[model samples]
Target: MTNGSPSESAISPGKPGQSTAVHVRDVTMDFGNGALAVSNASFELETGKFLTILGPSGSGKTTLLRMIAGFETPTSGEITVNGKPVDSAPPHRRSIGMVFQKLALFPHMTAAENIAFPLKMRRFNPKTIPGRVDEFLDLVKLGGYGNRRINELSGGQQQRVAIARALVFKPELLLLDEPLAALDVKLREEMQLEFRRIQHELGVTTINVTHDQREALVVSDDIIVMDGGRIQQHAKPVDLYRAPDNAFVAGFLGVASFINGHAVPGGLASGENFLSGTHAGDFADGTAVRGAVRAEQIRIAAEGGQLTACDTRLTGTVRDTIFEGERQLYVVATEEIPGITFRIYHHDPESFGLFEIGTRVMIGWNARDMKIFESRAS
Candidate 1:
């Protein structure tokens, strides 16, 4: 599949009596020398759902996706497709369609030819192939552009062709391998919408792998966050964003600031001040824990002006500010928190530098906004 040709599958209708599209149980992959690429991972995907495996580079997200795609066999556990074990099934025999990062369409072939390749390879009726190709070209909003060659088409158009080629055979499941990673920010975001639109329109069970957190949140019905070859958390996008299971997830999902302290009666105590927060892990009196608060959750104002609604308040000097076009990110340093800094996002892009570096400001957040997690060392 990485060699510019997909490991193709023939057309397969959904197996009756199975609502689950893919099931992975206790899957592990060892690459010798005590290297575990995937560690005891397990999950279930319902039919007609979009699941994204998201993580940073070398987090084994790609490896896990590959295992499910049948490119790499798991060292332990089983993967079932449509209620049947496919441990011995090769890539092309698993009723799965794959679109790779490279787009993998033939440069010499026209867009229509690229889309029609899978149908032809799978031995679909030659007469039906043309219509099927046209239907998908229209589905991807590239109807009349199919006559153009791969190089002649834009990057987004080529991606559409790859998606069309992969799905033209109507495989039971679709696998996306970071198909939008190479596009520029604007184009990548645009393709994310296109991907979601296509997935919803087709209602095909799909699994995608990517390191983009925004992409995961935008396109996935459910997401699996992986790190160090381990599955950290899996949940719907909203649930995962609002209720992270641990410190890593809380910090990973959003631009968050962390302050270390000992757990007090209701929240965390640093120095003589106590900051109220919601606790996610077991906390005893004086237990060391770190509290995480998203940047956007903290309200910032000129000292003591409009922060009466906040449960916790602090005065900090602006150490740095970044222009993010749509929002301004401020890094504030406060001495009251005992060697802690805070990041606050002001969405008013019109006021680019609300407070220049070294300006004093008051920052506050409600108790429910901060999440406290037990420190690993504790």
Candidate 2:
């Protein structure tokens, strides 16, 4: 048992017949004052799958994750772990491991000691503890770092130690609460890959919560986007990015620009300029709608060139341009769509000189690239 291999029974504890690792049914959390932190959230995680809950601050992403970890009870509905209801179970009673934003490794303890603490607390056989600690240190790629104190290791190394501690006990499920949020951009990105590698190696079902969209896209098998205490959309990373369910999802996933207009037969129209794009919903003609487009989706050309193949075309004056190393951001001001500035990301700076501040440019995009959503503005 100490060789870092989990017994079959502990890996799928509680229910031997269940295929689902975690099930949340109509769970809701209320925090007094008629405030609801999580509203009617429901989802299921298959065994050994990784799920990330993404949202902005105060969007209930953390609240929902805590409910699954048994740290917070739902005001309504129920949660089940490995086919057994755990709504009433305490955090220690459930077979789950958690890595917090603060690593939480004891500075006084060595890396090996930190990993061994959990095994000791869980009452693993004392004779097997040393080998288990060694196994986890190697599992996290910290084989020779067992003797180093928490402060002696780098930020990323400390993270590895925290992860080793969480998994050394071989819990059936793992919960990560923005564990990489504090690291620098490069280190955070690197740790994302580390997490995937370790999770695949162990096949542990994981639920991570973070406000970083890029982190969610990089590390999650499935992403659940939450806002205002409600689930907006849930899908795989690629599908969620390509086909967002609404304007909120579209705006949140990337750098987006929205233009308000009335829905026409094939797209939305702002005055004489008809922006052709794909649309959904059953609104009669002349219904107010917004067309959402990513910055990279639009093509920019000097002057008004021949863009006969493009579904939508317009000429705008370059109001501002930002040089961002590999790519340049151009803010185009147009009279066709008043009050909405189009953002175009030009990756090939050689082909297009940083358009002067007042230079006029032509821009176009295929109809399919633009996503239309019904506007709730009254």
Clashing pairs in 2: none
Tell me the whole-model lDDT of each prediction, alpha carbons only.
Answer: 0.86, 0.87
In the range 218-266, model 2's lDDT, one tens digit per residue, is 9899999999899989999999999888888899998888988999988
lDDT of 1 by residue, 1-378 (tens): 111111222233453224788899999999885779999999999887899999989889999988888888899989987877765665666578899989788999999999998878878888877787888888888989989989999998888899988887778889999999999999999999998998877778899999999999999999999988999999999999999998888888989999898898778998888898998867688888889999999988876567989999898888898988888999998768857789999998695438889888999999889999888762
Clash pairs, model 1 backbone: none
Which residue runs does candidate 2 get wrong by more than 4 Å?
A: 2-10, 13-18
